[model samples]
Target: MTPGPAGTTVPAAPDAPALLRGSGLRVTDQRVAVLEVLRGAPHADADDVVRAVRERLGRVSVQAVYDVLAALGRARLVRRIEPAGSPARFELRVGDNHHHLVCRACGEVRDVDCAVGAAPCLVPGASGGPVDGFVVDEAEVIYWGTCAACAATPALLATAPDA
Candidate 1:
């Protein structure tokens, strides 16, 4: 187990190469490094992944990191979430019907398990005038508000203007 944030001990990350192979992807240094970065830092943007991968494997290209992310996403090894007014972030946690809590003040994101019921938590009622005939496989829920830290600091509670 490795020490996670806030003195919590979390299981060590799975082997990156093994994960790539299991996902039917060719194992490469760049791929491994990208996976490692996501494991360490969840909700990282593509630019964040590129910087971390380059730090580990010197001289890596931005396109290469993007390609690795695309491959991982296709294999369902990683999930991408796009918060409004924020860059798309990637996380290694996939498959589960989880949601996210996004902080409007700091843009901090944390996982929130399925809210009330089973997979695809909220279902469209028969009153589905707009969603008629639409099959809902998954529901993307993002609760936007100030995080605890930001709430404690009133100065940080002000929402920034959308860019």
Candidate 2:
């Protein structure tokens, strides 16, 4: 595992074929391509994946990429994030309780350590939460703010009220 930027040891993401096999999914070019693309890109969307696949292997259909993404999501090989007022995004950083820090100005996203360390925030509300008839397995936490680049430029933030 490598030391992540957030002071967490990040496990090396599995290769595409191995990931698919372990997840009980058959290996395919589309799946491998999608995983490869996501390996370097943290938060990509359907159109981004499709464009990347087509760049690597020309003539791939968007529907095909979406299908492969669906399979990967079902297998938990990838995590999808849907920030407010943003298209759904996907990442290969799975099996962790990390949160995301999204930039309001640029839509940039970065992985952050779980709140209270070791995923203590997973409880439905807080400590000993998910009170009755509820099972909280995950929590989607987003800290929205302007990125350094955007924050550096006051005029940009002024124009982008969303920032």
Report how far off residue 40 is in candidate 1 (Å).
Answer: 0.4
Task: Give the per-residue lDDT digits (tens) of candidate 1, residues 18-41.
Answer: 999898899999999999999989
Model 2: lowest-lDDT 10 consecutive positions: 117-126
Candidate 2 lDDT over residue span 42-80, tens digit each: 689889999999998899988899899999999999899
Q: Which stretches of candidate 2 lie over 4 Å from their true place?
A: 4-9, 120-122, 125-129
Candidate 2 TM-score, C-alpha based: 0.90
Provide the TM-score for each candidate, comma-separated. 0.86, 0.90
CA lDDT scores, all candidates in order:
0.83, 0.84
